[model samples]
Target: MAASPSLANDNKSNVQRTKTSLSHLPYEVKQCIVYWVDRFQKEPHRFGSDSLLDQIAGGINHPGKTESRNNHPLLAPPSAQLTNLLNMHRFFHTTSTTNNDNKPSIRPQCNSILALCLVDRMFYDICRPLIWQTLDLEQFHLSKLRSLRTGGLTRNAEYVRKMSWRISVHELEALWPDLREELGANDEARKGQDWDESSRSTEILAILEMCTKVTSLDLDLRPTELDKQTGEFTIDETETTSKFFYPISRLTQLTSIALTTPLLANNSFTEQFLVRLIRDMSELQSFKCYGTDSVTPDLEGFSWPLPCGSPLGLHLSELTSLKELYLQQSDCFDFTWSKIEWAGNLEKLTFDGCTRNPLRTLHAFCQKFSTSLRYLKLDYLEYEKDVYTTLLEPTRDGPLSEIKSGQYRLDLPELTTLSITTELPIDLLLNFRDCKNIKSIELAMNPSISAEQIRELPCFWPKLEKLKITINTKSDLARCQITALKMTYWGKGIELEIEDEDEQYNSARFGHAYEDDGYDSYDSYHDDDSD
Candidate 1:
C-alpha cells in the first residue's frame, strides 16, 4: 500500500523541524552534549579487558598482545592489503569480550561517533577533535603511519593531547619496507644499503614531530623478541639505540613521562641524557621509570660524598616541580638520596621491588622528607638488618628515644595513605604515630601477624576509613577465619578488604569451605548479627 501524499508531506515537515531545532542550539552547548555522548558510548570497560583495580594493584606488568585476524602476502598485493589494514585499524580492531559459551572473542570497535558525524556538518566538526585527543599506538601498523603522512589524518595531529607508543623489534621489522618506500628508495636501493636502526628511529621521531601538543607520553622501547626457551633478549648497545632519546629530550612540554626500558639500567649515555632532560623540563611533575633490573646509575668518576654543586647534583636540585617519583625494580634510593638533601617538592614516593639497602639509609631518607610526604608505598622491600631493632627500637641515647618518651613522633604530618610489605607491620605503624591524618592503609601481612594484632589497628588510627589486608598463607581455612574476625572488629563504616596471596588456590578452596559451612558466600560472614 502506497502512503498518501498528505501523510508523506507531514513526515517530511516533522523531520525538517527537528533538524532546525538541533541547529539552533548554541555552539558550546552542542559541543558539551557531543563530548558527553562520546564518553558514554566509549566507557572505560569498553576500552580494554584490564580493570582500573588491576592496574592499581600492579597485576599487569606488560602490555597485552593484540591478536591478529588477517594475514596478507608481504611483497605482493601491497596496495589492496594496505587499504584493508587501514580499514581494520579504523573500525574492526578488537576488544576482549565473552560469548554465552564463556569463551573469549573479538568485539568490534564502537562507531557511534562516526554515525553521529553523518547527521550534519556541525556534529562532524565537533566530534573530530574529541576522537583524536588520545592515541594508543600499541597495535600500530606501518599503514597507519602511511595514512598520517599522506594528509589522511595529518591535519588532525594538533588535536592529540596524550600519546602512548610501545615500540618493539617486531614492529620495526614490519615497518621497514613501507618506510623505505616512503623515503623514495627503489628495490635496488633497498638491497644496496644495510638496514640501519637510525632509519627506524627517524620514523618514530617524525611521528612525534607532528603531535606537538602532547602533554603525557608513555614510551616502552623494550625489545619483545625473547628466546622461546630462555625467555630473554640481548640488549642492543649501538649508537642507533640511543637516537630515540634525542626526540624525547626535545619534548620539554611534557608534564608526565613513563619510561619502561633497560636503556636507563644498562646504558651510561642514558644517565647523562636524563640529567639534561630533567634540567630543561621545568613543568615536569610526575616521572616513573621501570627497568629490567635494579637501576643503579653508573657514577664511576664521582668521588665519595658527591659535591652539592656538581653537574648531576645541580640538575636534580633543579627539579622544583617534581611531585611523584616511582622507581620499580630500581635501586635509585641509595644513589638519589645520598646526593640531595631532599627532593624539592616530592609528595608521593614508591619503591617497588628494589634491592635491599641499609635500614638506616631508608630511615634517614624518610625523616628528611617527613614534612612534605603524603603518600608512600614500599612494596616487596627488604632491609640489610632487622626492621624493629634498626628502625623502631628506642635506646636512651638514640634519636628514636624521643618517639618512645612522647617528646616527638615520626613527623609525617601530611601523610594520609601508607602501603608497605614487611615482616613487622605493627612495629612500622608504631613509628608513624604522628601521622594522625592517615585514612587508608594497605598491608601485605605474613602468618606471623596474629588476628589479635589486627584489632589494634583502629586504636592507632581512629579516623581510618579503608584497610586492605593481603594474607600470605598456605592455609585457606586460617585465612578465612582471620578475615572474618577482623571484619567483626572493623564494623560497617570502614571499607575492609581481605584476600589471600594465592588467588586461584584461595578461590577453589573457599568454594568448598563455604559449602560445608552455612554461609552462601564469603561476604556473608561480614554480617554484624552473625555469630
Candidate 2:
C-alpha cells in the first residue's frame, strides 16, 4: 500500500475540521447544549427550540473554553423545600473566599435526564425513566381536593392513585358525589344516613377506605372541619376514594398512617373507631398521630370516655404488629401510660417534639426495646442537641440511659449507634461507651456549651469506627489549634501498644526531610526558632 497519512497529520486534520465547525456554531448555543446535557443528560428538541449555539454562524478562531463562572452551585436540587434549606449549610460552609478560586458549578443530574426525553424517541426512552423517577410522589403532598374531587372517582382520584399518595381529607368531600354515584346512593338513603348520629361520614370513611389499600401510603390526616350536629367530619377539600369504605373493620393493608389535627380524641369520641381501626389495620407498619384531650362533649351527662378498663380502650395495647411510630408534637392530649403498649417488633422510633404536657398517665416512656431499636431521634422538640446534657448535666459517661427519677441508669443492649448533638457537660464518655455493638456515633454542640465541656469529648466516645464530633473553639487562629487524635482498640489481653500501624507521627518527621529518588521534602510543619 502507498504510504498512509502520518498519525500526527490525521490528528491535525481532525482538529482543523473540529475548529472550523465549532467556531461556526454560536457560542451561546454550545453553552446551552452543555447546560441542557449537564442538568438533564440530553440535548433539547432538534426540531424547534431557541438555542444561542444555533445563532452563531462563524467566528474568527477555534472555539475555546470561556472564563469560569460560578453558576449552578448546587449539584442536586433537593426534593423538599426543607431539604433545600438544609443544602444551604453545605453550600455556605464549602464556599471558598479566595478571589481566584475557579471551581466549576454543578447542577442536579435530574435536569440533564429530563432534557433527553425531549430530544427524540430514542433519547426519550433513555431519559424518561430518570426524569419520571424524580417526579414520584414519595416526597410530595396533595392539599387541593375540592375541585379535583368534583370530577369523581372515574377521574382524578382513580388516575392519581396510581402515580401518587399523600392525600388530604378535603379532597375526599369533593369526590363524595362521585363516590355516592359509584356506590349506588339514592336520595332517600343519603338523607337517612346523614341523620344517623352513630354513623361515620360516608366521604371521610370512603377516602380512608380506598387509599388504605395503596401499597406505598403515608396518609397524613389534618382535621379541616368538625360536625356541629352528630360530630361527623367534613374536610374542606378531598378526592373521591372507593365507594364502600367499611368502617375501620376492613382496612388491614395500610402501610403508614399519620393522624394530624386531632380529629380523634376523648377516649370516648370513637370507642368503636379505635377498636375497629387498630384491630382491622393489620398491615399498618408505621403510625403517627396528634391526639387531643380524651374528650370534650357538647351536652351535659355526655360524660365521655366509657371507663378506661372498657373493652374499646384495650385495642391500643393490642397493636403488636406496628413497627415504627413517630410522636411529632403529639402531646396536646393527656393520654395515659396505659394508652400505649410495648410493640416488641418495633424497629425505629422518633419523638420529634412531644412537649411534656402533664401526661395524666405519664407512663409510656421507656429506654429499652424488646427487640433491637435501630434509630431514635428526639431532638427537634428541644434546643439541646446534646441529648446527654439534656438528661440533667451528665456528670459521667455511660449507662444512665433511663432517667425516671430525673436520673438515668438504663440499659440499652442492642444500641449499635449513638449521637449527642451537644457539648458534653461532664465526661462525654458514658456507660453507653460499653455499647459493644455500636459502630457509628455523631456528637455536635451548640455555642451555648462551655469550653471545658468541649475539651472532654475525646475520651467520651470509645471503640467507635465511625465518629463525627463538633468542637466549639476560639476562632482566633493564633490562639486556637485542633488535633485529630486517632487511637486503636485497647489491647484485649496484653498491655496497650503505643505503636499503631495507621499512626503517622507528625512531630517525628523532619520539616525539610528529603528522599534520594527526587521525593518532595516535607514542609507541613513550621520549624520554630524558639523550640
TM-score of every candidate relative to the true structure: 0.58, 0.41
Q: Residue by residue across 1-531, what tens digits does model 2's lDDT show?
A: 899757477456433432223224344433433333432222111211212122222121112324322222222222353232223222121223222224532323434444434545555443333332211231222222222233333222322211223232222223234434543545454334332211323433444344422432333233322345643444343322212223433546554444433122213123333343456675555655544323322221233543334333245445666556555454432333334454435555555444542112222333436245554433333333464234443564322233222243324556555545323233223434445555555444344444344344335444444544444342221223222122222221111112221342322111111111111111111110011
Per-model CA lDDT versus the true structure: 0.53, 0.35
Q: What are the per-model numbers of colliding residue pairs? A: 0, 34
Single out the weakest 10-residue window by summed lDDT for candidate 1.
509-518
**Relative to the unseen true structure, what is the C-alpha lDDT of residue 281 in candidate 2, on a scale of 0 to 100?**
73
The candidate maximizing lDDT is 1
Show the lowest summed lDDT stretch of 10 residues, model 2.
521-530
Error of 1 at 478 (Å): 2.4
Task: TM-score for candidate 1, please give it.
Answer: 0.58
* Per-residue lDDT over 431-506 for candidate 1, one digit per residue giving the tens place of the 0 to 100 score: 6766888888888776456667666777788777777778776323375777575566546466666776766242
